[model samples]
Target chain A: MASVTFDHVVKRYTSDLTVVKDFNVEVADKEFMVLVGPSGCGKSTALRMLAGLESISEGQIRIGDRVINNIAAKDRDIAMVFQSYALYPHMSVYDNMAFPLQMQHMKKAEIDKRVKSASSSLGLGNFLDRKPRALSGGQRQRVALGRAIVRNPQVFLLDEPLSNLDAKLRAQTRIELQKLHRDLGTTFIYVTHDQVEAMTMGDRIAIMNAGILQQVGTPGDIYDHPANIFVAGFVGTPTMNFVAATVQDGVATASGFHVKLPKALPAAKGILGFRPEAVTDRIPDPDSAMEMKVDVVERLGSDQFLYGKVGGDSVTARVDPRIKVEPGDSIKLGLDTRTLHFFDSETELALL
Target chain B: MSVVSPATKPGSPATKPVNLERRSLLSAIRPSRAILNIVLVVSAVFWLVPTIGLAIISLRPESLFQQSGWWTALTAPSQLTLSNYQTLFAQGLVARGVLDSLITSLEITVPATLLVTIISSLTAYSLVFGRWPGRSVVFLVIVGLLVVPIQVALIPVVQEYRVFGDLSGFNPFGTIPGVVIFHVAFGLPFGIFLMYNFYSGIPKEMLEAGRIDGAGEWQLFRRVALPLGLPAAASLMIFQFIWVWNDLLVALIFLGNNKHATLTIFLFEQTRTLAANYWIISTGAMISIFIPLIVFFSFQRYFVRGVLAGAVK
Candidate 1:
């Protein structure tokens, strides 16, 4: 029942310096919500506001139904896992996890039991007596998680918890985090700059740009239908390609290709958007096809990518790894009409 | 959190090989290493020669100290006796004997050291982590106090103590507590300066994490800042203890009218005797030197470098 809500939140340092501007999001109970953006986009600041570590300048943030702006951070009943893992370097693993419970004035026997169960759940049972300096980075991160979950708080906030891990461990921990969210059934608000973590782990992600949320949707929703050029470019690997195009009557024209419009647009000049996977080697329609002067061919075992210029614009086309291709070679690529997106060049908003 | 970084973990097997290679590289420069060790050993022996000479003189009879160098007692071991120590303690350990002065010195030094260490740590905790306005200015003022010499404040503080006695029943003049107050007052500026710098190096995330973990300001200081500031505090404790312990001016002026003397004053008095009691002076000097040595040795463990290395990424 601990649904979190941010109502018209604004964090301003000065008159001209606003880090988070009129931000809003409602995280349903037992849902995993990720607030993701680029560096300095105020994602971490937003999370810190929820954790009561930072003060809100203009609006109210509520856990369940209670406003937490005036509450002290310790009484907020929300646990935060810091990016640095911020484990007490002097305390043992068991003690580090038990510190929050002890702060509540819980009895010693209850503290021991909760600490023991939390340690084993985090696979830190045997390492209870060891100090944080003795553990590896991965072990310390789990200990940080162990410390967070021992409180059984109503909401959990994580600020780039996996950013410090290497790529391999990051992927492994991402899966485990989703599982933990399910088992705990607490509202989780995670902030990160990595799109992959947001895309894979978030039940729904809120994307922000320049302190403004661009869109809020499920991963498949945002991937299949982006609201603006920023969302279209921020998500997905290799990024979605945006090509300039001119729409007249019922036909859309680019530098070296044209496509028959399925729906009419109000603007004359617009940008054409498609993913690398949408550029196929097999031609489905001739009007949307163009010859690409191949500049670099990268074979990634599972898939091959062709980087080249289509007429005057550079383009990346995903092709079969088995098909032979080389730099300086010209290949004809067809843009799939069904997945094509059109945007008003001036507004940068998706039109079709 | 990958298994990739084990360089800092002491017990990690992967780090062992790296340490081994480092050790072998050191052994490769054995010739130069041996030269450095030899130089250090030679300098150490030269440094201890005077103390060794004093210890021998303290054990020798009064007649022998006047006739020859203290080294001569080493050749005639029979001349080395405990009679000088016996005479120095004739008044007994509790009175004006050497032990009594040593006890008085401890009474003055221990409180001064502990108070500075504690108050400086608390002051530093606030200076570094507190959001109060003008904190930097306050810190600068304290650090600026470090430049003021103790001599300037000696006469003024004595007057302040006399006035305080006039207003209140308890006069700090000529008492051990008075000396302790002076030492603590002067010691705080440097103590806070050191502790403030060390506490600043601790990441703010550590304290914020503590706050989210339901800890108050005091808990954060007790659990986080205090432990991390141990090296600075240890060094401060040593400096303050040694400075106050060896001080003759403050004890001389403050302990006036009081028959009790600190070890420094007592040792000074030995040199002023009609014949200059060299045996008592040498013996008392050796005794004075031992306590600071023990204090320094006990604090050696807290001087662990890179204590903050593994605490964060």
Candidate 2:
């Protein structure tokens, strides 16, 4: 019923190298929090530490009211689903799902009831008697989820659980997982490298990089108001475009164009950031926006993306699919001044 | 395991006569197949000659064994009799020796095999999964013990066992437990080395997943590690079982004419006299071969090539 608090948790292997550095976040009760990052960002390490699989090197990790830094994993009242599913190969689906409960010495009837209910929830009711080897990848994943769900743990720690599933299944499971989270209303902390999963599933997403917490916010907040250049680049699909710019007064100037900046901005010189959608193709006057040399045009049904260069810096624009322009074409692109972000050139922190 | 074969449809081109091109290709390999089969059958018979000879000698009369080769029974079929077996039973010395030896061998082999499997699995589990200091050194030392010949340790072990026996007022030398203890100690190093390699091949995430799923150290070992380790444990069981079963030197040295005689000791006693009892020896040898084959086949199913398949993907 209580939240998880990670207070300046530092996982340092040596004095110089730290895999996780001062990671601090308080996951709310019954909230689905996702720690999203690229590979080697220590997201898995953070989750493992919380799960008591890895020891926290420094600082305290408290679940509910007790500090569990020294507690054994089994006593931590948490369950996990793994990327590889990690199903007990020798056990049948029912036995695999019931193992933790059976370890707790629950009555056989109760375990069977729980296993049956959990399996039915995951749509694996018909395959209870089958071994993990006889199941498909998606089925195995559901079994793993069912195993964790049967525990009815205080916290559900998932380390890229849906990563091994195919795209369609991953998407379907993403929705079902969100629904399962709502149904159980238990604290779920999911870790994944996929931003789409984090964006779709997390109540609040924490973006991490190189062992440091970059930003923690709602998906929209992170996408709209990224705390740094890393979060900005990491959170988006096509990635936010960053051009070398010089901040004169409050306006950020890039290439040969002068773009208006949002009022009350942090005064910084260097990189200017804007999403692909922030730059428009149609504008009355050309000098008001950036001018680009069109390079490659990618046309989808609903959207067309233009990959091009403004001066020497490469920029991408998401335009209407009807706009037809081949490579090596010069085009006038207008900047959405309201959404422009200026970042410090040296530290890459957000200026606006 | 069922393999798919081509199906011939009525209206398809497959209904036509076989093409000469494919027919010749198929037939040329056929003559070689007959020759290969003949060679295989001949070689099988050639290799089995000694076992067949032993069987015949065990069933022939003692005078016949002394008078002619075992192949003589094939030419003079009527000369075959069960007199050797009757004589073996009537004397009762070989029977008691064989039974004693079997009990002794089983006493040594079962525990030795079991101890090696349990100890190796525990050691391998810790070496692969546990976070401790100098595990690699410990593992390396265990593997290093593999090269140390059992003969090198026999004198010292005997001396130590003698000292231990004196302290406890119960001697271990020329005892069944001593023989079993010696075999277990010597068999452990290779067993641990083998199981360690195997356990290391399992993905670390599975164990981590187990830990997060609320499985403690013992529970993780019992539930996750041990079940997954069956293939390794089975092979190790077979290896240790056969090794201890076939062992004569360690038993001969440590168990020295003890009342609890192993099969090897029983076999050795037949050759002890000036006139070796070939009839008893052959019968006893065949009986000794019987148990190992059974043990091998029992564990043969676990020798599956890919137990780890379909586990991850």
Candidate 3:
């Protein structure tokens, strides 16, 4: 296992078409660093550059003090599990897992041993003789994983590998992957657009948008203090609600609500950001609460969400599932002022 | 254990109600299905008539073959014998001609088909995966060559062969290699076209997976691309094999009536004689047809669909 570092990496296709710009991240040894973003955000491109599958237009990538920008993909000593699962269609599961070992010219017995052990670890012992088409999506994914694991590479690169599986399988595989990382103790660079996967899996998540790296932090750090408006909105379920407001005399005021800031600040226009969970159905204080005209209510059994208009801005609040609520119902919801965030309207950077 | 009625068995209750509906549906479609089968069988038999006639004529005595239609020998089974085959295979120039023609055809078709399949597959692999400049232009040129008639190239190629013979001591004209080269040249454009299209359908991720698995370009081609392109390769082999095997024009022009004559050239020679040797012609044609039929059936299994089913999600 080795640390991976991308220093000032830039992927420029043309003068007008730069996909990944100045990407810099240091994934520590045995660290699970996830690169998460929306599609076309160049998250996959950054991973591909590190995998040596794509050329870096500028800068350097080093794996354990060895620069790999000039190396061929085969010589990179890294394995990638593609989003497509990319198992050889004509080969059986045993052969698929043994392929990398075979390419290394390893002994037959050793290859067989490694394949058997990896397959067992993946719960694919019974499927070693089956073709990929014969296996379910989840099984194929495991086979892809098994193929990577048998290589015993310094790092494992997974490009949205769980995106192809169904919801239940994805959830199960997510936990299994985390376990796999723990067992292998290898550095992993995982790329995905799913924030939940990043939040649940990553030791540190690097969020990107429009060829720019927005923020890099642990899930808790990012959730509690987003570096920018994009990271705030992109990393949460139902997303964080942003209301355009003006800060005047240390109090931020919107159309129909006002909240006192923690400290006095220069008066300026800004956006108030708050997670749905930070908005409560119970009012702690009447002065800190706002009336929300509920437009839609989603009851997810354990937790209910109210999607409605609060202070002339569309907002979502996590509420008690037992509370009876319907569309068009008006309710006073309190804002957890301590957890609220403010972003400069002009720069979209966090103001607090 | 208590005795259980059939109706109480698992799936029996649900299946019983659908049985009547399915039976009525089957009855409604049965007549058309029968008609379709009959029509298919009839068409198949119709296609086999000429081959059957050739078989009967080749089996009948040469004298009887000249005296009666092949159908007459079919009615008078006693007259039908393997004497014509025996006479054709007798120790003489006739037997030598047949044997030599078979050898020459094999020498030409085998190499032509093998070379075309191998070269086309490699070229298609490069066209699909290679990152060099002008690759598409090269592919476009090959596809453009597909439209250039082989007849148009015959004279120029023959001249070029003569010039090559003049430059070197060895002349390809009137040799099996000459005809083989000609066939491979003309066969490649279509072969490459077919294989390229097929290889393009294979997801790029499969090759990338191979690359990250520590496979070089050659290993990628040999281990991954080649296996996935079996269907197209099989088809190209069949086409090139049949085309080169049945070729009389190139063989006649390049090989002439020398010792390296192919079966088609031999057959054409027989037809050109004033007497028109019907028995040899019929028997030789059957021999020619037999080889390709064997080839087609032998490689037919590779024409399977979904060979790449498990390669990608």
**What RMSD does each model have against the real structure?**
6.4, 4.3, 4.8
Best-matching candidate per lDDT = 3
lDDT of 1 by residue, B205-305 (tens): 88998899999999889988898889999999999999999999999999956778999989888777788588889888988999999999999999998
lDDT (Cα, tens digit) per residue for candidate 3, span A1-352: 9999999999999999999999999999999999999999999999999887889999999999999999999998999999999999999999999989999999999999999999998899999999999999999999999999999999999999999999999999999999999999999999999999999999999999999999999999999999999999999898998999899998899876898888677899999888999888877767778989999999999999999997679989999899999899999899878888999998999988
Q: What tens digits encode model 2's per-residue C-alpha lDDT throughout B134-209?
A: 9999998999899999989999999999899889987788877788788889988999998899999888877876
How far is B234's C-alpha from truth in model 2 (Å)? 2.0
Q: Kindly report which residue pairs in candidate 1 clash with one another.
A: A165-B1
Provide the lDDT at A121 for model 3: 84
The positional error of residue A71 in candidate 1, measured at the CA in angstroms, is 0.9
Clashing pairs in 3: none
Candidate ordering by lDDT (highest first): 3, 1, 2
Which docking class does model 3 fall in? medium
lDDT of each: 0.90, 0.86, 0.90
Off by over 4 Å in 3: B1-28, B92-96
Instruction: Give me the runs in candidate 1 sitting further than 4 Å from their true place.
Output: B1-28, B93-95
Query: How does candidate 2 fare on TM-score?
Result: 0.92
